[model samples]
Target: MVGVSKRVEAPSQGNREFTMTYANFAHIRDIAYDLTGITLSDHKQNMIYGRLARRLRALGLSSFDDYCNLLSEDSPELHEFINAITTNLTAFFRENHHFDFLKTTAFPNIIRKNMASKRLRIWSAGCSTGEEPYSIAMTLSATAGFSQWNAKILATDLDSNVVDKGRRGIYQEDRCTGIPNEYTRYLKRNPSTGEIKIREDVQEKIAFKQLNLLHQWPMKGPFDIIFCRNVVIYFDQETQKKLFARYHKMLAEGGYLFIGHSENLNRVSNDFTSLGKTMYQKK
Candidate 1:
């Protein structure tokens, strides 16, 4: 009699195929804009999902929804989420031509005009780790009697983790591959870690900070040269335009802005005049 009643299976909500929901994408997009002033387009949904999925697993959360709820709970977690998602790939003398332009043209001109002051201010915006600023320091150090002059470099990045690493001035030998042999000679190898670390002399000349470019900058600068290369590609057109305008305001008259090989400021911001091939001068 008990078997006479037919058993009915309740409708299974079986294995919900994971997809990046609009709500989830919007949450990530807002965080990016709030932290870095970079707007994530709808096309970057997959990127957001890929970058943040690990956070979910780490926290033992089974869903993106739960992970986001955790992020909202504390400022530290929010920072971790932002740092995880921001791209910070950079290398020393990444585009050789820009440095060549600096060595052959810009440096000579600046030194001549400011001989009395013998002062130079360079800012490496979006400087991931320490390569670019260290390269600039090496270049200045190589110039005869540069130590006698008032020369300094300021390097900043959005990720606090990378900024801390940059401040430490340590690097693996493999990452220093493209670094010139002369510069390598200046680096000291730690016996314990077998890691190459920038000498204190070179490191002392540069300062590193965690800066979110989209936010109000703390330092007022009439910087002689600003290297913000390869950073704007992640931003939308509007964000790029606004950022360039801000950069123009920060530059000293006749100062230069070096952008990525793929970037152009021609139509975006009229505050700068094209100086040819990824170089622009503030008007």
Candidate 2:
């Protein structure tokens, strides 16, 4: 939730001795891409320094070179370093309209048309910390009579740590604030631990996996719906185009693709026809 601002000057050339350098920027960019498939542009020079500088100080490393060397050491510290730099901001029902659309339009249509199939598959791409996929499961359970139907939600993220956390199905109360009251009733609150955990039935419907969008997709899918919202902002235009194309291939005929409000397929790809306002149906 921290805002990343533009850097006024380069760390090495600027008057400030503690500024980030070109070498540091390159190292951090490569590390980010290698670990999370997120490409840090030159504009993110300050962001790289701001997010990692404190870690460097804590590790007693005074220079970017030393920090980079530390990252290359292949220790648990290196894994922590990668986890700290990757952004994992997410909340339940963060974008409610997408869920509403899925419940009212997509799910109903899929159920009626695929009655013979008797199975539904939904993919929550970039499912940060589980909220998105959990929301999907809740929607299906409430609207689609989950007990009678066979349904599975595949939730994936590039960050292994967050993926593990999501699989645990535990969340802070504040994170569940926007969740519907009905859904809230299903969440179990443990007095001893003061942690809220998702109900077992809902958790069982979702399978969490670690996935890198930039790399080759491992799962075979002709998914009915793919919720890849709010993740492409970090990618370049070419990457975005390629990703959308891949999504087009992954989606089944008449399958739906939901992207972030800030993203569009207008310039990215023509394989998907716009379904109005951040929604798309594969052509």
Candidate 3:
């Protein structure tokens, strides 16, 4: 975040000639892939230009080449660049069924099985702006006997800016729209700011950290449930295979793994058994 510039200017309304070259685009794509494991295709060249153009303008750089040159050097701007380009489109309960599964099936089984210890661990991988992890927290808290269980959740994203927001546990009022009615009790309005805030009970249950799924994880444990929805859709086939394999190894036997609605595991890794659309249990 230190290296990334914060200055932003609105794009001129009409079409403008592009300044970036194919080589520059290729380099940017490579950087995103290598650093974040996100595949930025050629069609997204205009998008890359639009997004990075802000960074260039903020830094007062003359050209895309100037920006490309910084990539080869040790620059903190790279951190901001990924944060800018990486998509963070999410809302409370964006995928309702996944949370439904957690409340109805997965969590009930976990609560039943672990009643003695009353412990639960959930990972919200690629948690954007804390909505996903907070959603998990609220769902668990609303469950019967949930307070009796020592529930913990790990929420992570590659974007530091979003991670910071997640840590703050605040959002605009409209962002609370899609959250379920039952869980709305945990959300209260900040009278001064008119913004939504996740209650302390739900907020404290989660630990949000900045993480790149491609990197070596310091954690070791068989997580009871992992919510990696929509994160792997950006990765290539090989990367997805390796990522899922690592997840399989980390997930407890019979633990649940939830993926994006549009993502599938066909021909990827067979370490998990499919439990219908966008759901798998580690085999």
Candidate 4:
């Protein structure tokens, strides 16, 4: 889209606006893909302009060219750029069926299969604000015999802001509304501020970290379950293929992979067999 110009209206002080030339948008698209494997479609031009314009204003720059140059130079503002471009949408047990499957079927099988080891490892990839891992902890806590098991949940995301929030384990009361009544005991509600925090026991089960899926991973995992829901939908098919292949390698044999409702293994990967409802089992 180089040389193609899209006018973006900025705040009017003396009738000035920013123009996002095609080159600027292209540079952003490439950088996003190279840094995080997120593919920004052409239709996302408006969104790109909107999100990046704030950075320009914050840095006191007048043009997208200046912003792009700063990014090229690998300034500290790169972190802010990634944060601004990334989208995180998650909730406690957002897809209720996945949790149900975990509690009713997967956990039972895992418990029996690992009777001798009594160890469990779960990774909540793209766990926004910690809800998913906390929910997992609650479900495990409710399970029989789980107390005797050595278990941990690793929650990670590309956004540092959300990872920090997850580490804090705090949320406004409404953000936790999806939590079932039975799981309510795992939360401590603040009466004065109407905020909720996961009980320390549950919080301790999870470790939150900032991670880019395209980058080299720090942990060597034979994870029993991986919750990468809603994350790969942002990437191109080739990227998704490579990512799923990496996931297949990381997972223990017969481990489960839960993805977004709209995503599938079709054409992208053959390493996992569909268990239905956006869930797959490693082959």
Best by lDDT: 4
The order of the candidates by lDDT, greatest first, is 4, 3, 2, 1
TM accuracy, model 1 = 0.87
Candidate achieving higher TM-score, 2 or 4: 4
Q: In model 2, which regions exceed 4 Å deviation?
A: 1-8, 11-19, 31-37, 54-60, 70-81
lDDT string for model 2 (60-109, tens) is 87787877777774666666676677778788987788888878999888
Better of 2 and 3 by TM-score: 3
lDDT of 4 by residue, 29-89 (tens): 8888888888887778878888888889999998989889899656798899999999888
Pairs that clash in candidate 2 = none
Candidate 3 collision pairs: none
Q: How much is 46 displaced in model 4, in angstroms?
A: 1.3
| lDDT tens per residue, model 3, 1-283 | 0122232332332554337777777778878887888887667777888899899888889888899998864688988888989999888887888889888899889887888988788999999999999988898988887876778999999999999999899999989999878999999898999999999988999998999999999788679999998988898888999999999989877999999998999989899889997899988
lDDT of 1: 0.80
In model 1, what lDDT does residue 252 have?
A: 86
lDDT, model 2, position 114? 80
Q: Mind sharing the TM-score for model 4?
A: 0.93
